[model samples]
Target: MITSLDHLVLTVADIDATIAFYTQALGMTHAPFTVADGSTRHALRFGESKINLHVSGAEFEPKAQNPTAGSADLCFLTDRPLADWQRHLAAHGTRIEEGPVPRSGATGPLISLYVRDPDGNLIEISAPLQP
Candidate 1:
């Protein structure tokens, strides 16, 4: 049985670009750290979770069979409304790939805004619709 997720590995083309996009658009913080092999790696921290940035082919070891960019589609819950996220994304020069449309999330009714990260990963920002 699996518990809650700790982190997700993101295979990216450029680490700096990924950092810039996530931090500037999503308000995540850059958390760079050294691995056991003395190699430096970067992560984007939000709330209690983080995404470990793994440069394609330069990943630590025992990685995916084929690591590629723009492969992740992750949804993050937000307290703010869809309009607020639209403005926020616009301020950061992020294009909304899709909607402020209605959808069903794990908790129930949701309003989501889609944006692409530097690697073209689909990042969905959602807010649970109040009952």
Candidate 2:
């Protein structure tokens, strides 16, 4: 049986820039050893889950790869509610696509917001499930 999620992989063009975005902007720390892997891997700590970033190549641009922008979506859990996430994103000028809506799924009702990284990969920030 599946216990919990370990991490999610994200392909980026600029590994160093992505690392800085996660570490500086998103408040994630770079895991050691990954830096020496040569693929420019980095992991951001999210509770017990980690967000893994992999450098594909110089020509690897997310926007170019994901035109529909629906290949994959990543979610982040925050202690604050949807309103807080909205404010934080606005303060940082993060793009919001579809979100903060009560989504119907296995997890029940959850509020979510969407944003993209510097590489133009769609990422989501979500508040804990609430009725």
Quick one: best lDDT, which candidate? 1
Give the per-residue lDDT of model 2 (tens digit) for 26-78: 66788844333364445677677776655554332332454332245666666
Instruction: Give model 1's TM-score versus the native structure.
Output: 0.95
lDDT per residue for candidate 1 within 47-102, as digits (tens), equals 88999989976886778888899999999999888898899899888999899989
* lDDT values for all models: 0.90, 0.65
**If candidate 2 were superposed on the true structure by all CA atoms, what would the RMSD be?**
4.8
Off by over 4 Å in 2: 34-41, 58-71
* Residue runs of model 1 more than 4 Å from their true location after superposition: none
Error of 2 at 117 (Å): 1.4
Candidate 2's error at 69, in angstroms? 11
